[model samples]
Target: MTDDLIGKQIGGYAILGLIGRGGMAAVYRAHQVSMNRSVAVKVLPRQFIDDLTYMQRFNREVQIAAQLEHRSIVPVHDYGESDGQPYIVMRYMAGGSVDDMLNAGPLRLDQIVQICAQIAPALDYAHGKSVLHRDLKPSNILLDDIGDAYLTDFGIARILGEAPGSTITTDGAVGTPSYMSPEQAQGHPLDHRTDIYALGVSLFEMATARRPFEGDTPYGVAVMHVTTPPPSPRLYNESIPVSVEQVILKALNKRREDRYDSAAALAAALRTAVEAPQASPPPDPQPSAPPPIEIQPLAERPIPAPVYPAPSAPSLRQVPPASVPKRKRRPFRLNLWVGAMIGGVLGCALLTVVVGIGLLIVGTSTSEVGPGETPTATADVTPSAHARALVNETAAAVESATPRTPTRRATAITNTPVERSGPSGTVIFFAQRPITVDGAPVEAYNLYSL
Candidate 1:
């Protein structure tokens, strides 16, 4: 039945293609012929056309959505019935919904912040008008080509003045289980805080890329929303600042009163947390260690000079030649007393020799008694006592000076080569026997021929 709507004219709009489907309605891309502009047309499905319950809800969406006018709210342009099926025409969002962005991947912080800035205030504005968007989730929020956020789908919303204490549904819960507040999960009365809780869930998904609590069934997840405390946002995204996590926790508080007073307050707190400057780190308990001091190596240090004699000093003395060195000769010295005694002994000997000669001359002198007779010098060969003693001393000195001849002497015969014996056969032997003149033997050699 939805496919047959393709190329079909509905209220001066040509149907193009189906954009997406939801429990509330099916949205399609279409062109309004009168304005020559593109628009999003949401139509109630064929199965629910006969159901009064859905039909009335569809009609209520058309009425409420047209009343909202803001920069961040999707403007309702037209609404009409085409052949028993109700359809709503709204300004087409070229960038698609936040659900599409979540399906692709987690959103960036700047984009999420920018989006929240637009949508959060829009929600606050709606709440101020006594309008409560009971079903506020990612799918209900749309974005334009320039990343401008626009809140849509006021289908399950309530004009709070019409019914404040009554439940949005008569049979069961109305909002998404994962995003539902604790009171909404328990079927208790709800206020603007429910939407704030849902926005916290969407922020959680944008930061962590996953819902805080997950289960096999919607009832189980809803039970966790009511009973369990929200897990820390930093648990999923460690890069999230502690301040930002605190803001998320405050917005997701179980009790509605504990949460931010308004959606604008939540957005303001989030912005301040994100844009807030990082705090200065605490000072360390102990002082920093000192820089290391480098020590010189032993090999690089200069050696000290020797204590006794410096090794680097040069010698002053000159070196001699390699040949033998000559020794110095000392002058001779004689004693004066010894020289005098030697001179005295020589004088005595000379005097004795002179006197002996004089005595011999006197003894040999002839008396001149007869002049006529030729003076013949008839001399006695005898010396006076003094002279005789001198002659005796001289003889003794000469005898002692003579060298003694010995017997059995070896004589080298070089006179003739009689036996050709150079040092042996030509030798003679002489033995002496002294003829003593009554007492002493004389030193002589008597030769014996061989």
Candidate 2:
């Protein structure tokens, strides 16, 4: 059916090319002949025209999406049936979907915040209108060329205040399993908070590059959403701020009551977190130096008493003349004793210096040789470039393996053009007028209605 509709004209709109296919409809790039504008057309397959459930869902999506008039929502231009196939014409978006960006890598923190901020207000507006986007995931988020986000795909949305059991339900569970909130997974009645939970999941993936929960099958994943606690975003990407993680965790609370009261509240938290200063980790402690050693001055030595050499004088037999008065040898002996004491002190000082030098050498050699090895002089070897690179790489690997406290940087919000006004009696166009899905002028449609 998609192949046949590529060049075929349906309901006065010529199908230019196929955009993509979904479970229930195929979106195509089409030229609205009557309006002379290029638009995206989501066409239901011919096989599903006869199916009551699919037809109801298709009509419901058209009704819900057409009434939504906001900057962050894809505006529906027309809806009609041709050749037993149903299709809805919407403003074409050229920048593709958030899933496309996620495929490349995890988005920057600032980008995630900006995207969430855009989506939050959109969800709040829908909630105000009694609309619940049951299936809110990255794939349903469309982006513009300048990176503005728009929420699309309300196929499974439930309209509040409508008759009970009026909308389609599959086995009581109707949302994508991976992004389903706890209540949605349990097949319980839902409210706006379910959409908030799904948005939290999308934000988690945007920040962490992976969903918080995973399982082998759809049912298993759904079960995890109900039973498991979401891992912290910092666990995947250490740079994610604590405040940002807190906001996400609050949005993903298992109990709806614990989650954000409204999308506006969630958006407010995100904005505050993005603006908050990041707390830095404490510095590592340094080793202390050894204390100084004090040396005491040597005490003065007492003079030795003159020694009488009676026995030595007899042996020498050299008696001095009386006139000479036998100059008391005490002075000479005293001088000699002083010289001997000085020499002994110098010798002790030299021995101490030699011991200290030897000890220092032994300590250094032991450290270089490491434990349980005899000390030997090692030849200095210059490493080749390849070996040096390998060593550096190995050291880096080890350093990375040794987990350190994660540090986060405050993400400054860049001055990107964003639409912030809610649904109001007056509409104002900000920087860069809204362009069509194909980057063409949007004519014949009031993209925003007061």
Candidate 3:
């Protein structure tokens, strides 16, 4: 299949080269002409296209993957069949798989936390959407350029709404032995917690650089998953904190009830354990001391009092005469005078303000009526009528004295000429003319404009 697909065009994607090969499918780096970008294309073998079971699983992978939209989940870009073969197009992850990273060496504690934090939420999202990643393992988890983990390859995932025994195979179990939970290994009904167990195994390997259980055969490994209890991660690396070990153990529990209810819950516990401070060792015990003596011998003789010579009197030159402080009579008189002056000034200012206000009112009232116009009101009319008469006279005088210019309708100049000096020459450009008032363009005068 890899040899035939190297130069073949599938759907709208032009196969550029092969990226990796798997048991069921071959991944290739393809150029999507529509998007003008590179993408990873997983092509299933042509033989499986005729098998209803394999076809259904391939379709399920497409449907389930298309629904999951998350930063930590590899996005499905396109899926279709071509030349009697099914293939799925996904984002190309440049950092390879987590399994590849583990092959080199064990991940650091910080790296483990970072990967789990991303993976847990992705599982939670899938579970919330009623999908289960039945075959979760390190290989299924891919990383990006910056080390962000993304869960991929949901080929064997079981939808929660499917009927019972729908996913059971003739051989019974369906997932990888080393990463399968007890329920999964025993062919029992699975749920989101099973994925949590698998994640636990992946995390254990990440922290300890080895799996918790190992066997000579796949069957033996599957059996150990159901029967054997996970060893403490600290056993592999004593530097692992105790809190982290407890978290891993809890996730690896045989019974789903004993484990975290959701992947998010497990992730929270992992983060807390990794970030928590290690417990300090107990202090060494102090030596026991004897009880104090109850009785002590009295002193043989009474202590004598020590005497010292008296201090000599200070000389007359050193002694300052005690003069009575003089009463500050001038300050008291000055404060009274200052207060009186301030009071007078304030009174004068108040009077000036009041006179100014009164003059302003008189001027405004007188100006309301022109000199030639006399406001006369009937005896039955109220003061409001008189004020209305004065307002009418003022408006009439204003209209008569002001010159009436010819009313010109504003015309929208769509292309007004604008000139600016540029490096090449004076650039003449056309723009929409702005609204103007009395031949003056409206200028922005607000604080923001200034």
Best by lDDT: 2
Off by over 4 Å in 2: 169-171, 278-450
Query: What is candidate 1's TM-score against the reference?
Result: 0.60
RMSD of each: 23.0, 50.8, 40.4
- Model 2, 341-372: lDDT tens digits are 64465446534643453454445445666567
lDDT of 3 at 56: 72
Summarize candidate 1's per-residue lDDT along 1-450 as a digit string, tens digits: 428898999989999999998986899999999999999999998889988778877887777777788889999988889998899999999999888898877777787788888999899988888777878878888989887999998887777656443533433467778888898889776678889998988888877788889999999999999889999888988988777777778878888988888888878777877887244221124576799998889999788887795577567877876998688865333344654564456446645754555444444433423556644322442335654555456545533443333322333322321221112122222233232211223332322211
- Runs in model 1 deviating more than 4 A are 163-172, 277-450
**How do the predictions measure up, each by TM-score?**
0.60, 0.60, 0.59
In what order do the candidates fall by lDDT, top score first?
Answer: 2, 3, 1
Clashes of 3: 0
TM-score of 2: 0.60
lDDT of 1 at 212: 89
- Full-model lDDT for every candidate: 0.73, 0.75, 0.74
Alpha-carbon error at 444 in model 2, in Å? 99
Please give the lDDT score for candidate 2: 0.75
